[model samples]
Target: MTHEITDELQGIKVLVTGGAGFIGSNLCEFLLNNNAIVHCLDNFATGHRENISSFLNHPNFTLFTGDIRNLTDCKNAVSSMDYVLHQAALGSVPRSINDPITTNEVNVSGFLNMLTATRDEGVKRFVYAASSSTYGDSTTLPKEEDIIGKPLSPYAITKYVNELYANIFHKVYGVDTIGLRYFNVFGRKQDPNGAYAAVIPKFVKQLIDHQSPVINGDGSFSRDFTYIDNVIEMNVKAMLSIHPDAANNVYNVAYGERTTLIELLGILKEELAQYDTAIKDIEIQFGPERVGDVPHSLASIDKAKSLLGYAPVFDIKKGLQASVDWYWEHLK
Candidate 1:
């Protein structure tokens, strides 16, 4: 669903970093549909060309093949933009654990470069893709913005650093900034064939192939699996929000509910079974629990709703059905 002020985005100049990846591509499409001049800066390091191929020729869409780790690239991308949606970063806790140096360079150093550029360029607002991983070891049932535990992974550390930098930029440099702490977001363009692919898309692909999907632990661990549309709505609102308290703050972007892995797997089977009945018969295998993984994650969206007028339209079941439909058509 479109935000109330989405029409305000018309004629707006916006830059979406990592705009060729799943979430960033979705943002690029939505912003373009609303008549925004969208510049996409992605290194193609993790993002795919196929994701933005449909929009490559859109009159309002411009693609800049660049890396955020490079200061010059970051400055060029943010130049003359009304708003900056910084979504570029190295994700995956396991990947970070394996290679902390690269993660820090991309997530932390790159983030600082973007912040510095946005501040210097005088972009109206800077909204970024923060992670729920920043919540880290906290056992809080519904994660609030202020309550956070020590980071459990290098990736979490990097994301947290982003929030700190954003806050500092606003305080020290008068930069308008907002950080969206995204939970486990999933949707159509999400890659399902990577070593560090999100669990939902990855599992759906395995089940579609009639292979058993592996679950770490006993499948009791859960997360606040956010949908892409919800995320888009949040981004738009954060970019356009005029509420005094909305800027220079962090907000949790989630569905405000939790779903266990077992429950998620069950729903996936049911949705995919409509297209291929054999998916229901595929067994689920259990493996050792992943390191740097928390047992459960739930978000408190009260802050976003009150501050940015944020409302999530799609819940898990509906979102899963939509995702399954896309994957079934594309993957088959």
Candidate 2:
């Protein structure tokens, strides 16, 4: 039914929670483009209707506008799926800090509901969005799958809990799953507006509008900002993979290159300048370091690479180009 990974998901019924968000929307599109039937669930808390409006009429697509924090919604969404890509958690470190309780409800409790449903349904494999934040306070560069540090914020703890619960589910309930520790992902369908918007899109929007973008903490802190296409590829591979050694494991999904935020801003400005050189005038304001944020985050993707045969198609430069062009087209 699907195109690219038809060999893996032909006739498979998949459930993608938070399917209306940026990453989820792209994932839904990828699945439909490949021929898999996708059931998308989102409360529109952060997702936009226009994101999935294009697919409402598709025969293979179904929409459930419900909060993942609601256990009933989680149960209903996973009822008839072969694989569950649980991507519905509340994001943003700032957002979590603002309302850690709400973040806990959606990210932790909501995640357990999905995991329970996955176990109850006995799905072949469940793959969910793990975050680079799980690396937490680790001083090590190029974070590996096994090494980790104490979580700095509620959001980090929640994502880290996803892995913990998944492991427990495997040992206690025999539910096999995969957790993808996504690095900073940016691309098309990413929202550029709102208080909690990601760095790339937010900065791109500001530059497009000739507004000065804020650089948190001198921008010396860098991250392994991954592209959306790479994240999508990892999800696809995770679902299709039948590797015995890869099941119930967490893999870092990234391009393995560290770029500072200052450097990232330069690229965003340069890329936006392609459409309008006036963007070059966009200045940056350095502010106090954000609370509950890591100084740097870079992932060692060898686990995903050697096992899942994952090969990233875009690095930061190419990724920023795609993301900038997309925002310029849609938001601007």
Best by lDDT: 1
Residue range 261-294, candidate 1, lDDT tens digits: 9999999999999998988889999999999999
C-alpha root-mean-square deviation, candidate 1: 1.0
**Candidate 1, superposed: residue stretches over 4 Å from native:** 1-6
For model 1, where is the 10-residue window of minimal lDDT?
1-10
Q: What is the lDDT of residue 1 in candidate 2?
A: 14
In lDDT terms, how accurate is model 2?
A: 0.89
**Which tens-of-lDDT digit does each residue in 146-196 have in candidate 2?**
999999999999899989999999999999899999898888888888999
Which residue pairs come into collision in candidate 1?
none
Q: Best candidate per TM-score, number?
A: 1
